[model samples]
Target chain A: MNSRISAFLADRLPLKNVENHIKKPLPKHINWLFSLGSMAAFLLILQAVTGAFLAFYYSPSPDHAYDAVNYISKEVLFGGFVRGLHHWGASVLVIVVFLHLLRVVAYASYKPPREMTWVTGVLMLLIVLGFGFTGYLLPWDQKAYWATVVGVKIAGTAPVIGDFVAKVLRGGEEVGAVTLTRFYALHTIWLPWLAFGLIAVHLFFVRYYGSAGTPKNTPEDMRSGKPFYPDQLFEDAVAILILFIVLASMAIFVPVPLEELADPTDASYDPRPEWYFLFLFQLLKYFEGPLEVVGTFVIPTVGFVLLLFLPFLDRKEERTSLLKRPVALTVTCLSVVLIMLLTILGAIAPRLEPVPEQPPAAEQTAPSQETPEKAEEEAVFDFGLD
Target chain B: MTDVPEEGQQRRTFFKIGMAAIGGLIGLAMAIPLVGFAISPAFRKASKKWVDLGIADLLKGSRYKKINYTFSAKDGWVETNKRRSVYVTDQGDGTFQVYSRVCSHLGCLVRWDEGKDQFFCPCHGAVFDSAGNVVAGPPPRPMDKLPVKVEDGILYVKES
Candidate 1:
């Protein structure tokens, strides 16, 4: 073989590298659960690549944004496909991540030495959430705008520093140019860079420790252990294949959500969080009334803290958290409450009612019969846009 | 799904742990609106945008003039009243010229002097020709013009 091929075979980054790094056999009994890591990686890569492409066409303006993206879908080559790819990629990333997280949890993988990895994993989850938040604003349509309104409002619920938090996020008391510019910068540049760095550290430690052994037992014979070779490669390849099919199928069929032009002044519009946030959205409802703090910062905040502290809390000798019933049960109970609360709150949240303002613009109304509710419903004061 | 303990570990004290969890979840459930309601207003401050005044006949041909107007703006919680002024003239075509009534030097309001046929910024010894160009003063640049757009018979000028 040529020297180039020889060098290529020397690394583990490519299939060619598999030749140089050939070693003992893998666990012949490896299951679908073991393949989730590669699948998550596949999805994350897709999100980053597709997100970069979509960024080129997306306008971060409250006024022209919807039209700008619409123009791309109609005008730019493959714009719709790329946008679809991005949309599905986000969902894929979240799903795959959760699966990866669960696989680790289910296997009782967050043991000693792997503690840092566990903490980093939680950070990765938060980064995914951050990605979701910032990306929502990129479209700048009514849905995105109002969703942001609710988001900022929720953040405002942060106790003593509520207004300050809101202002810091908004660059003022409300979302506008300043907010758009900040989110755009943070989304495209800041957060991604940080995520990439954190991911590198996270992955380095993961590999440094070796692919975690499954809960049952470690093999005594070295030959029985899996090498990061053909066996793993085959599974990873299969995972990539499955990921592609799912993303493509969703992209082709499910038209991405597109809202009307961004009208922050449109009071009737209700803002809801993205699907991933739906669970948390549902949680707030139960926290309503006297226990508002529990809904606001207390619960989700505590859950997030628990997620971070999992490594410290679950430091047991067993493999599956199943081995340590109490700790596992506690975490499980927390997750259940978190998800259940989210569901209830989401169901209960009154559709957002814009603070009653002056009526809608006359131009928005049809020349036909203008009924009172239609007048009321359609009537909105101009927040001053062309 | 709640985490299920191992089959072997499922026995004993189910009620105790269950009750504590139920309480914790309930407590969190109660805190939502107390936070949502309060933070919402402070979270909502105000939004403002520059209004495009279609066209106002506030300008007279090549003459120093002071035009005054008041307008209302919705600022989240309050409607703010605004005041504006400008000196107007004819700038080629159908467009008329407009300039700040405030002097370019120190922003003191300027006045039209029919006697010299010029604009005078009395507070700082500043002077301007009829076209609202600074004749002599500590001004760094010429007087700023407000954007004007005329639609129908009404003339409106930019608030900025």
Candidate 2:
């Protein structure tokens, strides 16, 4: 008992102090890729907190969903800002997670004890995407409604399992009241709980391995240098504090948009999801029918599986950056290309563009060539139909 | 005993360094809004000031008049000009009833048709009775009213 207590107290208690949290210096080479992991986690909290509050005012019914969103924006205090942050936060979070994953690949930070970290991160990325696709349908506005119609149609393209997946997401043949409730449940309860559990698993790896510092590009990584307790903790704390300030500033101002309520019958509004999903939208466009089958499902799935195997596949003799050749360069090129492609596709992806709506074709000009009696008869037909 | 840089040693040095860095950051965050709050009055003068549109006597029944006003908000950036109209009628008890000419349906400028004894929406064919009640057509709601107060024979509107 005496020895154990002594061990506990003698542990320096450095884990809890602000000084220990900030003073420990990091390796100089940490880059933008390294920064996004913290940013992704930051956005998750932002989304969760704002989303919980929004749930307080929102209703799940088809008729009321749009109105409720509008009411919160117009009638409720600070509701606009909360709503905006959740929306914009989702867009930005997806971006940061992609960068985080790319950094893991480029620096080969996913090597060794870090491979599971990368895998869990990929799962998190997909889950984030799940959150986004489901959440897009919640407002039940024209854009959200129709954009998701297209999205579900594409989901229905997945061979053997397409209909089941589509049915589960929509809760029926068409998106209706049941779909909204199902999505609301997924958004507010099921997805978040699943996300929390997955996040805990993901972060446990972080805590176990500590942060990978930078690319261990030299022989020195083979030797012990610094204990992670103080240095890494400090860096993580600084990131967290900065994130807190951003959240506070955003909460104070940039409230979310509650557009004129989501009306499914308002067929004129063209549906578009938040910008990040535009690549997938573009991919679906580029490939039609058989090719589309490969583009949407087969290709992305295979690409993701390939990415999972990368650490094992590139088994060179050295962890040294100077020794590593083609793999490093390939990783960098791939990250840049994918990001650019996704961004551009997001821009040009054909949305369910507003149908042309030709304005009832000008009342047929009363058939000027017709005799007066026939014209009179035709006019009577118009009136008679009414 | 191990040889050391001092008694409180390297740990004390790290603590002092950290405190200064963190204190500086937190101070900077606090200072930005403090400065904004301090100069906010000067910011207000550089922009627009709310203009009062006068007592009910100047307004009349069945006529739409657009009155423009400017609101002073925050610094160097002046707010854009604003416009609204007042329509007033006799309530028969020596009191006058007034309503804004703005349509609640979609913020289109509502026209008072004295001949028709109704308010007409040129955009969507919405018709309102003399009392701003929807009598015919597609307005899902009634007209919005502006709050007004009279002080010493002058009228003032509530602006946010």
Scored by DockQ, the top model is 2
Query: DockQ values for all predictions?
Result: 0.01, 0.02
Question: What docking tier does model 2 reach?
Answer: incorrect
Candidate 1 lDDT, A130-187, residue by residue in tens: 8888888878788778777778878888889977888888889888878888888888
lDDT of candidate model 1 versus the reference: 0.69
Q: Give the alpha carbon lDDT tens digit for every residue of B78-102 in model 2.
A: 2334555666564544444566777
Shift of residue A140 alpha carbon in model 2, Å: 1.7
- Computed on alpha carbons, the lDDT of every model, listed in order, comes to 0.69, 0.67
Docking class of 1: incorrect
lDDT for model 2: 0.67
List runs of model 2 lying over 4 Å from the truth: A1-35, A217-230, A240-255, A263-267, A320-324, A349-386, B1-160
lDDT per residue, candidate 2, A227-324, as tens digits? 33344334544665665566556656766544455555777666665677666766666677568798778867777787777666667634444236
Interface RMSD of each: 19.0, 10.4
DockQ of candidate 1, scored on C-alphas against the true complex (2 decimals): 0.01
Cα RMSDs, all models: 18.3, 15.7
Cα lDDT tens digits for candidate 1, B1-160: 3456453134224433543554454334323422332234355444534444334444435454456667787432234687877766666576766677877787798888889978888897888877667788777777777776666745567775
